[model samples]
Target: MAAADREFSPASSIALTVGSALLWGVAHLATGRRRIGLTLLGSYALLVATILSMVTLVGSDLLTLAVQPGWLTALTFMLLAIAAAWTVVIVWSYVLVRPDSSHPGRRIATIVAAVLCGLVVVPTVYAARLASVSRDVVTSLFTPSSAPIIADDPWNGRPRVNFLLVGADSAPSRPGVRTDSMTVASVDVATGATTLLGLPRNLQNVPMPPGPARQRFPSGFTGEPPYTPGLLNEVFQYAEDYPEVVPGVRKGYRGPTLLKETVGGILGIRIHHYAMVDMAGFAQIIDAMGGVRITIKDPIVYGKYREGLLPSGTRKLSGEQALWYGRSRTDSDDYVRMGRQKCLLNAVAKQADPMTVLNSFESLANATKRAISTDLPQNLLPAMVELAQKIKDTRIRSLNFVPPLISTAYPDYEFIKRKVEQTLADRPVNKTATAPGSRPQSTPQQSPERPLTLDEACA
Candidate 1:
């Protein structure tokens, strides 16, 4: 039979129909006499057959009705067939697991089963509708004529571009909640050089923007604004104190823009784009990918009274564990946590199967829509997917800004100004321009130790 006709194939339909009928017949037979329910069984068999056929064939047709003008219709039908087959398996499992005895519990079980079946169908149907709506919304949001600067120059002269990626623990209208975590990713598209810069939540004072200066205070200070001039760690605590005053505080931190500007100044690179992913969305995407594997370089033990344990070795982590791994910093310092973040990212990158991700695109897209906010254009999605396909896990390199590289120096205003100046000055200079302090040094023997002290590290 042709593929389209296969959806309506009588043999398959009859088998499934009969199977369902036999189950219902057995239920009725257990209640009373078998002979009395023969007619009921026959009627049920016919009803099931008709319903199955209509739902499988007609439902598939209706979904793919406006898929496209050509071969896409067939592809849509095939996808629908797959979805229906899975749904059938789920429903069949429910039918078989149900008890045959006609007790009050059985009645309740039957009602529960029916409700569950409806619940399953409802989401699938709703997801399909949501998918359709999201497709249109995405299409409208991303116009082909207009593209982002990153898309235009994926391999520009700049070796690295910093992106401040934030996960706000709370929304603006609500306060007291602070950002769960803050990450700055520096991407060098040309060489596939990527680094995940993780900032500590409790480091001490980090400067706050001018907006609601009154509300933002350091962690320890009461009545004083939370804003302090110290480490990136203290920012969240300050934001928490007077959450109402800050306009865009998520959790206690201000918006992603603040972090972006802060990191950009430190790194000496202009932030090309910013992407924000919420905790819930992060979990969904990780689960969809069947979890990720990370090789832990150091043993970590920490909890209430330091009870949690993760030995040093390769371990496959579930979404729940991964979240804890990402968020927890009590055992290790912020620098080590930054390493963990990069490790998690690398693990995800290594295990990410394109076909699997493509299949879960609907779920992924839906999850992203609710939890993520990015300045990057939506139109670049297809291109990004294609680029990801071409790049191997080994080709991607992860870096962290720590120790001697980027610091959290005090005299906050002066440090920020100097960092920004250094970044602007550290542009991709032409090889021919032999300027002092710009050219590569001669040898390791002649080079001086460039260790960044705690003061420099903070700067």
Candidate 2:
């Protein structure tokens, strides 16, 4: 056929085919395949409309759906389906508009179209993989409570929800898990304000709430034989060893259940949930986040004979360094280390921004799965994530029952309760106005009357 009689020039056909990889169906319409072209266009428009409508209607509840393993699995398959459909469209479009003659240009156009198809599939496949990983993580890490506080409300319509963060120290050399670090994170459901109450590991005479354990230790914890004089941290191993004392507790939750009751009794508040991380696994988590940045006021010494040293100054520390920063007690008492741990928590929370999380999500997820255990129901994750976003920038208030204010050997339980009540009652403070890279203004010297923010404690 004469050039004028043909539908399009070779170059024009090539352009149309390439453009179709992006515009879907345009090549078909340009090549007189009107029926197929209109169908593809209509399908694309409908998909867009449906997505927009879902977003508009669902709003924040979309996150609620995200936490469901079933939904996530479905999402992975759906993403794959979409990728397949789109790839088919790209190839079909190229077939419809490719240059008619057997020429080098036609071969080149074929190669270009293949590359474009790959570009479209690669990212979607990656997204599908992420969705699959998320499903596995949710299933393995979170156990949905058979009995939630409320059927509809994740926070159970409470003003505040308290979670006990326990850093458990369990080694082959040790008999059972030890609650090395215990902090209660009480969060205001509405405002996302939080108060962290840190309890020293060596806290003695910890009162237990009314229960079987309470019945046994009516006069507060005072270490049983083998475990030695009862310290606050010993409660975990004690509970683990004597499961009959805390009967009816979940299989793996006996220790946490008893510890929760004990801590709640001490704080005079109902502990809603508990999250425990192995002290060893904490390092992996830190590494996953690419390390935590902290302002070390003085050199920290760790290891037997003080072989490890974390020098003073503002430094970005690796997983091991952060572990030492929070755990070291050489020349420093537990009170000082408690302050350092609070600072470390604050720094990790502030520095692990969304981009960092996204970039290292796989490693972070893997480390998190191995390192942590929690009684927080899977259904509550969406709400927890929502709350975290709200409070990420809010200054964290802290109350450490250490030294001067209260002796670890004889903690004033009544005084501790009053301070906890006071801290929670106070409105959550905004992030301090301290200049970047400089020390935060010191909190009025730790008095019985005042609590410290992370900034103040760290400073």
* TM-score top scorer: 2
Q: For model 2, which pairs clash? A: 222-230, 223-230
lDDT of 2 at 182: 95
CA lDDT, candidate 2, residue 207 = 79
TM-scores of the models, in the order given: 0.50, 0.89
Mind giving the per-residue lDDT tens digits that candidate 1 earns over 163-188? 67666555466443355456666555
Model 2 segments more than 4 A misplaced: 1-10, 56-62, 146-152, 427-449
TM-score, prediction 2:
0.89
Local distance difference test, per candidate?
A: 0.49, 0.80
**What is the Å distance of residue 282 in model 2 from its true position?**
1.8
Residue by residue across 1-459, what tens digits does model 2's lDDT show? 532234554577668766776677788787677888889888888877887998999887787777788889988998898899889988887776677665657777778778888997999898898888888889888986666545457776799999999988776777788888999999998888888998999988777878777788887788785648788898887777788878977557788998898899889999989999887788898999999989999988876567788889998999988988888888888888888887887788788887998888889889989999998788778788788877876878888877666666656677667668867886433322332233333341243546677788787
